[model samples]
Target: MKEYIDRKEAISAIREYRGYFQDQKSTDMMLLKMEAENILKDLETFDIVPVVHGKWIYTGKEMWRCNNCDNEIAGYDKMPSEYGVNYCDRCGAKMDEVEE
Candidate 1:
């Protein structure tokens, strides 16, 4: 059996081999190159990791709220308004309070 190369050495060799394969597409060269790639892939079996949690954060848009001091509220993404009390922030409350 052939001896296994260490991961770093294997990676470097694979990079070199890929460059050579790209430049020369002969059948015998491709076979050898593919064998080298298979070995590298085997080395990769030890490298996978599962993502646990708390991996990201969002810091984009401002918080949306009800136009009135009403208990209900709406997010900016859901409903957008130009002026005050365009729509019910809570439960789609309408502008019932008329103005002079």
Candidate 2:
């Protein structure tokens, strides 16, 4: 049961709250503002997104493309899968899903 939030929206809301309370000088307000600032910092950090996984999609008789990245693999004599690749060479998507 994972949860998610819109990072951009959360950041914006924190910014708005901090801005709205900028004129306050009470000790509790100051501490809350500092916490809000820390929250904004955390919200702005790198995303924890799920890894994009996909299979190879056949595009032509001699070409197959990565479904996650659309990076194409070209072969002259044999299909790309015959080369025994386990991952996409360009985007590094794990090649474990069914080939199309």
Candidate 3:
């Protein structure tokens, strides 16, 4: 069975691999890149996408909040972008002017 890790541990592993490659020689960096790819592949199996944020990798899920009702939504897909901006599902408020 595949070993599952929580989101916090996954982010930490990515950060560690990132730090490991910072000052390495070109040849060594290539090897490190391979290792990093393996880590990313493992994370993919868990439905977690890594996004580079400045110096750290973060979960790619973005949360959108409803300004009218204060409802928060989050997921890899099925986000507000998938739905039309004309209405909010929870409160039926107009969402056309909502900014990303």
lDDT, model 3, position 83: 52
lDDT of 3: 0.54
The positional error of residue 51 in candidate 1, measured at the CA in angstroms, is: 24
Q: Write the per-residue lDDT of candidate 3 for residues 3-99, one digit (tens) a residue.
A: 6667566555654565645788867876766676566667555474432211111134665666666656555244454554345557765554532
Q: Write the per-residue lDDT of candidate 2 for residues 1-100, one digit (tens) a residue.
A: 7677776677567656756567778676768856866776675354675665767777876788888888988772454555787678888887778744
In candidate 2 the C-alpha lDDT for residue 98 amounts to: 72
Give the better candidate number (1 or 2) by TM-score: 2
Q: Which predicted model would earn the best lDDT?
A: 2
lDDT of each: 0.48, 0.70, 0.54
By TM-score rank, best first, the candidates go 2, 3, 1
Model 1: residues with Cα > 4 Å off, grouped in runs? 1-9, 17-25, 44-100
TM-score for each of the candidates = 0.24, 0.41, 0.29
lDDT of 1 by residue, 23-59 (tens): 5557777678668777777763344333221111112
Q: What lDDT score is found at residue 36 in candidate 3?
A: 63
For candidate 2, what's the RMSD? 6.7
Q: List the candidate 3 regions with Cα displacement exceeding 4 Å.
A: 1-60, 76-79, 82-85, 98-100
Name the runs in model 2 displaced over 4 angstroms: 1-52, 76-79
Model 1 CA RMSD to the hidden true structure, in angstroms = 17.3
User: How far is each candidate from the true structure, as Cα RMSD in Å?
Assistant: 17.3, 6.7, 15.4
